[model samples]
Target: MTEFIPRPDQPASTSRMPSPLVTMIVAGAVLSLCMGLRQSLGLFLQPMRAELGVSASAFGFALALQNLTWGLAQPVIGMFGDRYGPRPVLVVCGFLYSAGLLLMALGGPTIGLNIGAGVLSGVGIAGCGFGLVLGAVSRSVPPEKRVQAVGAVSAVGSLATLVIAPVCQAIIENDGWQAAALSFAAVAATIGVIALFIGGKPAPAKDHSAVASNTRQAVGEAIRHPGFVAMTLAFFACGFQLQFITVHLPTYLGICGVSTEIGAIALGVIGIANAVGSYVTGRLGTRYRPKQLLALIYLLRTVAITAFVWFPVSAFSTLAFAAIMGLLWLGVVPLVSGTVARIFGLQHFNTLFGIVFLSHQIGGFAGAWLGGVSYDLTGSYMTAWVSMALVGLGAFVLQWSMDDRDRPAPGIKDSLLGTS
Candidate 1:
């Protein structure tokens, strides 16, 4: 009998390999563009409100729709990305995003504003946001470095805020808000083109035999796990905190008597600090349990919110809050995504994680909409701030209780008990 051996370079081999650095760079750029555009929405709130003659509630509703839409669509988009590859999804989402921006630029009454800015732009975001991009990155990079790669990708989103916020503000100030919207739309369209550069064709469809024996088993196993549930709920808090602040922080500052310039600066500061936070958290994730780190991050956010509420408003306080909050901002993303990958394997990470992220967006919708509604009702942000603090504490407790362990394989009594 002849001896059989596997070749080293065979595509079917299970050997681990590092993804090209260029893949990371491209992923970062795509994330940056997506996040930068999302964060820049705050800059347009006031101007759009004035030009369109819409109420705060109307603007808030539009933003709320955006968040809700993104949340609802994320899981679906992620599933498709996982099945079909991220490149096509990115391209399609880019076009929808640009169209949304263009519609907003046209200026409108409440219906148009809500539909364009809220619904259309949101759909775009769902397809292009962290869910799809991070999924791609997770597949490309080695398993050991997955957490770090997530951090790097998240850092790009933060960096986009740092660069794009100021640039959007300047455009609005110099060329006017309409021009700025057009310019932003142009940039978004460019992202569609850029997404074509990402390599890796989609995985081929699994045959019926393979699907029943392996794929179905894996999906069923992950769905029944307790840790996955905990991870999903914890991520809800992260979304609520980030979306509420990012959407309303600029407007909140305005209510406190801060200038537009200061508001923009505050956002820029948050972005810069967020970049630092992401980098640190990414590195720390390698050594620490992500659940514990999440608890700490939420605690810090609670402290930051309390301090901002207690302090008197000034240029100093504004910048201080920005810096402190930015540090806590977006730092949770890597850890959250990393934890999911750890407990549930990356085989169906995109689809599974996207479902988790959908919960986050639901929180985000509440945060953004409620902040505006509270302000409209009471003409003060005190209530909103108090609510944020309470939510932060809640998140701390939730994350603390999560058990970190590898999930058991299906149909194995010992492994099931081990997971339990």
Candidate 2:
């Protein structure tokens, strides 16, 4: 028998690891279900507020709470996933997601909305969303193939928005908002079931004491890394911009005299285009540096927002804006996740990315809440839109200035599938 050791640059592989194809397929399905249902919640906003007699600010606050909860809960859930495995965590979150949606449907405006939409759904999203899912995917594939794997999952998952948004809109139109909420609950219940097939769990560190010490060191190293700090800060802008648009765009379109159908159509267009963008961006990651690509995304997003708002709103302009925005959308995920893996290796990837994502969710909370406050106070979302663009421009500078060079901790190896 020969002693085997994997180099720090190469991940250890073994027979017990799940097949890459199976891992990808299962991961993609989970993403599609979880993200699709989550994103479509915006469709319930108008009807729920009208019926519940809730102020726009109140409704926005609930959604804002959801983002905040998701962020606050992510690192803890991610730790669970990293330690116990994604399957059980995802299973529990799926049911939580379903229950939250049900509560939102049944619980009156404030209680249901806050507890269901804000708290439970937020925690559910923390478990099933990009940070944990992508971390799982990354560990299942080779470093050279990691970008493509992540991109593919993101692209496939993005397609869910195309169908989910429209379906929810139709349900809201025909069956009422409560029915739409219930439908979302039903869909969410499937996430856990699908998660059963996802593979790749964290390898146990050789010694429990060593693992504890390494984790502390790893967290400190990431915090001290200028690139990680820059990336985390820049991610806030990403959340602020995207969430503001997702939550407010429908209302903005309605204000501009576009039909609700047109708004739904715009969202669908975004979904379709996002698939392409996610895939192309992943391929581009192979050639261009992740930091550069991220900077470009922010710059382009700022331009699109500036142009979309500056010009008068029309169905044509709205859909066109959606196309542009969609193309630039989830493209950020692969780059961000890949950067974490490259810089820190896989040991604490989910937790590290969760920390970065907390910044994003904080921005989400601000963006969603402030959009309502701005509109309520100013009679226009123009102020929020302007703020979003400025923040994005600032993120561009931060991302561009980041140094994303690989600097894994001394004891951390590229523990992909088998190595402990």
- Best candidate (score: lDDT): 2
Per-residue lDDT value at 299 in model 1: 90
Best by TM-score: 2
Q: Estimate the TM-score of every prediction.
A: 0.89, 0.93
> Tens digits of per-residue lDDT for model 2 on 42-113?
777789768888766788888899999999999889888767777788889989989999999999998899
Per-model clash counts, in order, read 0, 0
The C-alpha RMSD of each candidate to the native structure, in angstroms, is 6.4, 5.2
* 287 Cα displacement, candidate 2 (Å): 1.2
Q: Mind giving the per-residue lDDT tens digits that candidate 1 earns over 182-234?
A: 88789888778877776645443221112223445655766677766776777
- Model 2 has an lDDT value of 0.84
> Once model 1 is optimally superposed onto the true structure by TM-score, how far is the C-alpha of residue 315 displaced, in angstroms?
1.4
Candidate 2 wrong stretches, greater than 4 Å: 1-8, 12-16, 204-212, 408-420
